[model samples]
Target: MPHLNGVTVHPDCRHFRGDIPCRPNKEYGYQCQDCPVYAPTQQRILIIKLGAIGDVIRTTPLLRRLRQEYPNARITWLTLTPAILPQSGGWIDEVLKLELTSVLHLQQREFDLLFNLDKDKEACALLGSIRAHQKFGYQLHPQYGVAWPVGELANHKYLTGVFDELSQQNQKPYVQEIFELCGYEFQHEEYVFDTHDDKGYDWSQLPQGRPRIGLNTGCGDRWTTRLWSDEKWITLINQLQQAGYAPVLLGGEAEAERNQRLHAATGAAYLGTFPLPQFINLMHQMDGIVTQVTMAMHISIALRKPTILMNNIFNPYEFDLYGRGQIVQPDKQCVCFYRGSCKLGPTSCMEDLSAEKVFEAVRVSVPLA
Candidate 1:
């Protein structure tokens, strides 16, 4: 992960001194009350989380809650156009795509409240421009505004305690607190992307109603650790086909080589290099998702699709559970959890997980064929 640089704090900076009426109040950390950007009951709110698909997935539940709290409020999610695309819903009236070109122009909107989800220095600096009445996010480290600074939860007892600080009450239900802080109420059911169409793939080429299974063979750069070897994936898909399940290869151009290799090995269904929205729709068509630990896994969870996540170093406890998948770990416990790459040669943890084991796990977790 990239550490925060001095770019977070410019030399000619506007510091949040308590003396300035517009300065953020420190009593509630950056949850300012007297600041010119401190209006809690505004009719309009702006939410910011500009990158990382997983982070975007996690931040979405907060949107539902924000809607529940203020039904009449016009809520907008301001996110980088490429990194995320929020769905139109009861909670969000509009998704304002935050292109780099218009970031400075945000000052004109005069938003009621702004929640900075990504805490990057670039985002912090940009917040200086939004004419919001309230600004809520992490307190800048004495050095880098809010660049991953140790926050109010530095002395936290449990992992959940960290999220508690940003919320209204820690003891409340998890989803409830998440909504309350985002200023909305939430429905407990997971979110699912509508996937009714055949997507843009050459679906007409394949037989109709084939018992298809989806395979996500690659994770984005951040989650390369969870990626299984091409050899192992090919082996597993072939085994599934022998048992009568028609396996379908799925991925973006990023995983085109891996998908081709697997398809060659199995002579199975393949949806290669389609547009993202169409690819996602195709994924939804499959019986279930077999993937590495990535945003697709989270998407599968939200869709309530049975998913098996092949993990090399990820802990099952750390994530919301996926019903039938096995988590592969090294015989020797891993030292890195949230940071650093697996330095061990060949990544013994995942490489050791045999095709038979993965196949059996998937079979039991998902109805065979």
Candidate 2:
């Protein structure tokens, strides 16, 4: 009998890189496949999702499913926002940031399966060049050719971005479609938001006996029209206070100045900016969150906080709030779906979606019981 059990230890060894061995320390003083003292490698899987932060957070529904399907697989996730890795608990064994060194390291080894969800050219190109036993999601752009979404699951996601009509007609929420890409059922899968941060927030400073509502000021630069006018936010702030809710201001460095103005104008508690981890911890205090289709909205949904989503340009159906929140849209039918700017010019569709309607959505009796 061989010195080993003749069983491949791919799930317990360090050198095993799919079929390519990366032996180091001269442990066996020979190639791994030829060695008798081989320790098997854990089932290796790689998940690639570079960020806009929101996308990074939402992609986590795959974690529970991936764990169920490949229980012993040592998973490695690649992303730009390294902060989220800790938040994922130990679901992922390794967190590789997008960089030249990380790229080279990935290319050096082969994965049992590599799932690249990013549509960005760089990610697709890397997916094309990497040596994986199997790849799902988008793949490389052939020489001078455009990158293509690989499977039937990605076809709808791919076309939605390529054409106007497809996106308008797309009824699938991003989470459901992405789950399908990984060969899993939607079944109301939720996002994982537990970070390593154990910081505690003092909610004592907030006004008593009032619904603590968060008003996120910025909608990000991608879609300027997605943002309600400053006057509109101010209007909502006044309305929120009148309705006996304590409106707290939430935003990033970009919105600090804007939030400050809103804060001063409305006398709302301005919880100044903190790091992402601390910020996430602070969000727990909110009874509800009001924002456009932004990262704050994703965070609130993950926390299962009552979120009042303000949508104008994108399909409201694309968001799966898990039955925890209400989606408020403009009374006007969006003419420019998935578009950055509106065809209606100065008269934005949002103007018709009045502050009163959004306020109604924000005050939903209580946070879903």
Candidate 3:
């Protein structure tokens, strides 16, 4: 064993770790001073986007722009759902879960730039506490104790979030708004999703020779107003089957029972629920996706799957399908805009969104062989 000197360590190297040997040394036995692959950290960027998983997936597009702007930056993303974020070998050098340990670590570290995209109180408060030379997006207002826009760029998003009427009138998609928040122009940068292709998930059970269409049946529990009737899903499934496409029921544990019933009723393929990575792999098999404005919709967009997005309560313009999908809404406008439950007793505008319209969109999106 040889004695190591403080001068021998390259602390600014992107791969440098004080507590353990870096990857270059571990694999090739190269000391930090002689490491051929050593890349110095140009900038340290911290992004706080504690999420609803869908937002986390959509926020991935920002990573591309960030990489382009700061090629050698060591980007650290602090999020509630770390699992949903891109893993190693991606733009993000570190994915820290929003917990006490991560909070403490972040407090001690300094960043060249900090972006707190989320308006949540905790997220804003964290942004306030962090030591960053420059900050963008929202921050906790010291006087108001509420999240407020840090700069003029963030004002548009902030106003839209606070005022429903403004949101309704806004035509800018989510990706553009986030890009503007960071003072960058939106160039239709694609999402950086970790498809877990290396996992080698066997999806042979799925029917072949026909275009596989994924029908994500759940809109999540928070927004029950977005839920479509079983009759509509069944109708769409039957229509897809008749139109020479394979309709595959997709959902998580919350939708397991409903998906099972849909499968039994229409005899469409239902492969069952899976963990996030596995579920994403299953969705990867689809030629197209039909879903409400839920996590599945974001995932579908990330996967570049042609999608038919059903909307009722939220602004259709809020979503950017990357031109791969179309938004289908009810004939009658929803009275429950931005609502969790239908205001109209025992009926919803989602009922007016005909299954035929969705089927037609699917046919156009993923046409027959």
Candidate 4:
């Protein structure tokens, strides 16, 4: 572990000074500020996390607990603009988009503490400007800024476990942990979307009666991890419709061509023509979701709606933290862990994942039948 020039790890930092505020207030049922777990000092803190959608979702509990720990203190989160504010809901008091070059100017306003959820070199360098009383994250890369070597992160451990280790000096805020760290329970509430009413959606055009199920055929940027085949998707859509489900297709503009192909192939309802928010609106109206390890999965988790995650490039062990779904892994024992591309062309993990198997998992999760 590297060490920051002037920073030291406070091994004896305790949690919960027991200054909890009243529960069920006018704003939040329980205002996080009243919790005694926050530090006794009034300090301005900043949390940094920049990654894919799911990684950001896993950090919610940490942010919530931090707020509870220091209700009187100011907490600002550093992340992409898209992942902040409107999408963030009240997780952090403020969000500072990570624009290092531009933030160089704001370095004049110092921070009392800096928390790093990601360890990119560029991001760490930017933290050098802010005068943080306490700096937390992986040790800087050799010649960078801070040098505090946190422990190695295990791939097998859930997302919560990895973050728990980073904040171990404080408290593990996961709701499912053995010890109640923050003295407050973490609840997975429905994703609160503030619709500005500036969008248009044709809800009346959607078929009525049967449960709505969203089918996702595309994976993330990485194609090797996708386990579902187009043919299988077509088969699944047919099976779902026959089994009394109103299957709807969901994806981004990047999926336009694939969505068109799938629509032509299976004749299922394609809602990709609408804008992104409109697509989200449709997702919100749906009864359930079926997808791979993509952003849609995170939305479904926040929705607390029953979901079925098809493990494509990764396994259930990689993303089992945000529960509320059945993870469908590959049947082939040949490649246990996701090995880049299959030695024999496209791996069967995703392609071989049968619609029948998926439908079974769906039935078990949502009980469509």
Give me the candidate number with maximum lDDT: 3
Worst 10 residues of 4 by lDDT: 9-18
Residue 362, model 4: Cα distance from true site in angstroms: 1.1
Rank by lDDT, highest first: 3, 2, 4, 1
- Give TM-scores for every candidate, taking all chains together and pairing residue i with residue i: 0.71, 0.86, 0.97, 0.72
Q: Which ten residues in a row have the lowest lDDT in candidate 1?
A: 6-15
| Candidate 4, residue 341: how far the Cα is off, in Å | 2.1
Model 4 lDDT per residue over 137-252, tens place: 54355554643333333111223443533333323323222112222344532333334234556588676888888876666665445646677888898898889888888887
In candidate 1, position 297 carries an lDDT of 73
Ranking by TM-score: 3, 2, 4, 1
Clashes of 3: 0
Q: Write the per-residue lDDT of candidate 1 for residues 1-369, one digit (tens) a residue.
A: 112352222111132222343234344344332234433333678777776665566566675556656665666677765324545334565566667655755667777777765556676665666777776653345565555422333222123434533332334443343344443444563542344353344566443554566788888776455667888888888888887777788788788987887777778777567765666667667776787777777666656677776665554454444344555453456544433366665464567667887777667766753
Predicted structure with the largest TM-score when compared to the true one: 3
1-369: candidate 3 lDDT, tens digit per residue: 223665477788888777898888898898876679888899999999997999988988899999999999999999999999888664888889999999998999999999999999999999989999999999988988998999798999999999999999999999899999988999999999988888999898999999999999998878888899999999999999888999999999999999999999998999988999999989999999999999999999999999899999998888988889689999997888899878887777899999999998998888787
Deviation from native of the Cα of residue 304 in model 4, angstroms: 1.4
Q: Residue-wise lDDT of candidate 2 within 1-369, one digit each (tens)?
A: 123576434335544454454454245455545466554535779999996899988998888888778776878889999786553355777788999999998898888988989888888988888888888888765765676888786777778778878877889899888887766788876787773246665657766677788888788888877878778888888988887788899888999999998888889898789888777766777888898899998888888888889998888878988877689888878887777788878667887788888888876734332
Count of clashing residue pairs in every prediction = 12, 11, 0, 16
